[model samples]
Target chain A: MTARTGVAGFLGRVTAMIVKEYIQLTRDRVTFATMIMIPLLQLVLFGYAINTTPRHLPTAVFSHENSDVSRAILAALRNTAFFSFVREAQSVEEAEHLVRAGEVLFFVEIPAGFERSLRRGDRPQILVAADATDPVGTGNALAALSGVVASALVRERFVGAIAEEAQGREATSQDAFEIVQHRRYNPAGTSQLNIVPGLLGTILTMTMLIFTALSVTREIERGTMESLLAMPIHPVEIMLGKIVPYVMVGILQAVLILGAGIILFAVPVEGSVAVLSAATLLFITANLSIGYTFSTLAQNQLQAVQMSFMFFLPSILLSGFMFPFSGMPQWAQWIGEGLPLTHYLRMVRGILLKGSGLSDLVRDGAALFGLMLLAMGIAVARFRQTLD
Target chain B: MSERAAAPAGTGERSAADVAIAVEGLSKRFGANLVVDDLTMTVRRGQIYGFLGPNGSGKTTTIRMLCGLLTPDAGRGTCLGMDILTQGREIRAHVGYMTQRFSLYQDLSVKENLEFVARLYGVPKPEAAAQAALERLGLKGRGRQLAGELSGGWKQRLALGACILPGPDLLLLDEPTAGVDPQARREFWAQIHALAAEGLTVLVSTHYMDEAERCHEIAYIAYGRLLAQGTVANVIAASGLHTYTVDVKGEGPREASQRITDLSQKLSAALGVDMVAPFGTSLHISGRDAAALEAAIAPFRGEPHLVWRKDEPTLEDVFIDLMRGKDARR
Candidate 1:
């Protein structure tokens, strides 16, 4: 009987504890709402917004002759559900520039006299240069290239032997033409080349954001902010004091990650080191400003951390860190454009893999600058000077 | 109004420079609840003002308003001759506010916390200032220790040391000795008196009655209103309560205690008896009218084994009467 009563007593104490916790949980309305909303948001975002096998990738064509066979090949490539012919370059130089600038993923070039040579069965070659920096984005689209072009020529009756054979003539060899494939930037299509630079952006965003997000809220929770605010100092001075130290830490963190990326993963910096440093500095400051803004908005340390995670989830998911940028629907891409990591990822990859200069990445750099100013503005405007 | 009107002569009329804090008609509200309502008082230079009230009775709110930590929703005030609303930053520069809770950074050492405050207020030679403060507060040996690692008494001392590091002319302390030991509290008061002798005005809030008696002047507040404000003697005299002490004898010690409890209950329900309280082995009964009190106690005074003597009412009795009277009016 004593043992049974002891067990019942334990159960009774546990019941009281559970009831107390439930009441506390409900009293904190922000935490309660976040608990229910985060999971639902994740479900909706992952299910509808993400796509792995991306389609309608931008492509450019530079055909030497306006022949029936070239038109047929272009139409055939469009019908394959993998390519979107967004631009038709007037010259090979223009097509190469389009691919290099990342405006188009693939450039198709047909040499002069290719149609006459094919008619005489000389077996001429056409060139298809693919921007292979993100292999996942261009892999399947490049794979369907030769088959679609060959079938389209036969189907269009542009192949001389195939057309003649339709009138009961003897058939000849069916080798219509040749295709020359050139993979630019990363010729070997190594995944490490793509992932390492992306990891640099992802790591910086997570750490810089969380560091500053907890800075002010921790002071507030510990009651130190009360004494600090009671002093004769401006709010902007306090904000700058909190942010400047973390910027130094952020710089050290960037160096550590980039050093590890190069020494361990063999990822080469193909562009000017000055340009990379400038962009990294800008990106770090932008993330820190955004995190400080969250700190001002949150009521306490726990809420500040939750707000950081809420921001980080979208950054990692929609910033093309895990998936191809072109794979998501249009609206999701627009949302990605507003995130700093999305633009940073482009600049880092453009600098590291493709050796893009500052002029080529100016637009992305400006976007990061604009985001930093906006977050800083909100943080300053939301700062409270009194205990009202 | 009665307390102010009955203030001891020669202290009320002062020039602007003689006043450390002077405010009229101050009020503050949070959401739907009014925390401080139409309160007004003045503190002269070099005076140790004691702020007394129950918990959540706006003691801290009043102190915060004085130091410009909080803006009064409706009123005008001045701290050290600077306007509370228009010149908050200037007022804060001359005032040091030690919050009720320990507000120094726990992760920092004692010296570091002091130096941080010194630098914040732009004190020259911050390192030397922090060292001198440590020596003065008797915390020279604990300079390297974290503030959070100290006991309650030591933390309170360190908080005070940090507040005075900047050498402000005025100090506002909100219950600095709430959880401290008796010995520490006495020492803390001695330090306050020493500072007052040096011409620094201090406004400290506390719940201890003995501490209230130590103040040069005191203010009693309840329900967001200042019920009384004056010298301690003046407040007690203005209460106008006639008190008597009664000692009841019974068969044994337990019986005597029981007799006193029963007598207290009976006297509480009698006419003209406004307050009945037990202190030690004696019972105290107080009333507003002396004649009515004498008639009500005539029957109890003649009872067997009961001795009654007229006595002066204590500060405790007067404060209890003030609190009860406020409640009855509400």
Candidate 2:
């Protein structure tokens, strides 16, 4: 006993601990496969299925005058990437029905006086109405319409100026044109690029946390924990033994997700891979620790899984994973920023596409580190006390 | 520390230096109810010590504390010469405990479970140890069988093998033969006695009187209190119950029984007759006072329909008397 108190002895014990854990892990085939395969599944599903930058938006037009000017506006709208002219309406009533039924997201109506006003050098009014139910769809429609309107106004003023110069009239009147632009992040915004990277965070968090939460509680239900506890092993050793295998799974998930993002959506890893990997590992650890904490509190495997879903629900909704962060109310924005997922998502996107460095990711990194320490500390403390 | 000669009780078979376990003032309480009260007892090495008690009499709790699986709330004791409090791990290491219910891995094979336990206890050469245990327990052919698929008797055998594979100095069995068939119970006791003969101290708790009679010494506890402690012969002698069997012939056994009950009450007032129980076509009446018991059944002696003869009080009579005495206290 005296001779075995040094480094050699400690290493021997650790090796025995690791070998025993691996043997037990291999015996449970379902859990082993889940650990290795779930990440790859998540990567492919989220990378290809989710796209935030909207394209080919369905639009309808209503023209009362049936003139060349009205026809020209419809043609210009179709020229942009934002709108795909789906139908034409003879009256406003027909266009309104299309919008309400969700047949078209945007509709343009030209009044009866439109051609007459343009010919008399007076401003002709045109109405652009878009469905506001889906905020993303409405935003894209408005962006494309604004570009079309500005060009039309510029051409009209140019024509009037040219006519005045040819008539040699006193240049008392002025031609006015203004183009107001509203740009959301990556404003020529490709939905695939924005959503694919964010999906990586959401998918990884849900799968990894849920799987870890069920692991311990399942053993407890099966009565295997009694045998485990009877062994002359420390609780901390068991915790580490359980987590090490899952950490490898987390890394594998990250690689699969990154690869899918590149191959399917051209999501570039513009930042340092090391920085991204480090941040990702921290966030995954935080999530796993949270799951372990739930496991300690739950009485059975089903309850533990349910509790994991409960945590995941608020995280996905309030973390700005699906919606634009700035568009939300101030309180919601504050809440979104406070969530651990929010910081991790921002960090992931910044690193993968924005080429963010360690210095650039300080805030997100600090938040994730704090969350990891807090969650792991609470989980270990709860688990140790739970056994007693 | 003074050397004393062995007491001449059961021939020179018992020795004074054979005290394997000694404990004093053992008490444990759960919340408001006391599960085991202050108690003192001793067990000799190479002996099967029977612990008999009714259900909820703290037999299991006492056994657990003795084996170092549980800590007594207030007590001082030594098990296998290790301090119960400070050297619990060491005590547990040297004591094999089998619970009433079968607690084993159902998914694992019998051999795998034994090997796992051996490794957990840090046994040297676990494979060899498990193999030897299996062969010794007559489970050599069924070592690879799933534990869940085994019958009750087979499961019991496997449990016994797992417990003894660690080579503990003492074995604590809590109702080890419960739910086992008559033949299996006999076989289990044979194994227990064999282990006891090899200087392995055995403390077993059971409700069967036959099992209690096989032990070198028996202790009966009721409601957290020790009711009796001694060999079967000594306990029966101390009970002081005298008995008489009355045989009734013809189709009037029931009528004769009623007539005897009336006679028993009359004699109880004058001579203190204790209990009169009907056994099929016969009646057995017993009392602690021998003179009173003989005088009480005198009236039924001269009839052909009822024949009364003096008989020895069985162990069952002694136990029934003890249970009645304990019940009267509550």
Docking class of 1: incorrect
If scored against the real structure, what TM-score would every candidate get?
0.76, 0.71
Give the residue spans of candidate 1 off by over 4 A: A1-182, A326-328, B1-13, B248-251
Where is the poorest 10-residue window by lDDT in model 1 chain B? B1-10
Q: Rate the local accuracy (lDDT) of all candidates.
A: 0.80, 0.72
What is the per-residue lDDT of model 2 for residues B31-125, given as tens digits with 9 covering 90 to 100?
88898998777777766888998899989878867765567888887887778667655666677778777766666788877876676566766
The digit string of per-residue lDDT tens for model 2 on A37-117 reads 665666566555544446778888877787766766666777666778889987888999999999998888888877677
Could you tell me which residue pairs clash in candidate 1?
none
The alpha-carbon deviation from the true structure for residue A86 of candidate 2, after best TM-score superposition, in angstroms, is 3.4
- Please, what are the lDDT tens digits per residue for candidate 1 over residues A97-137? 99999999998888888778767766677788999998767
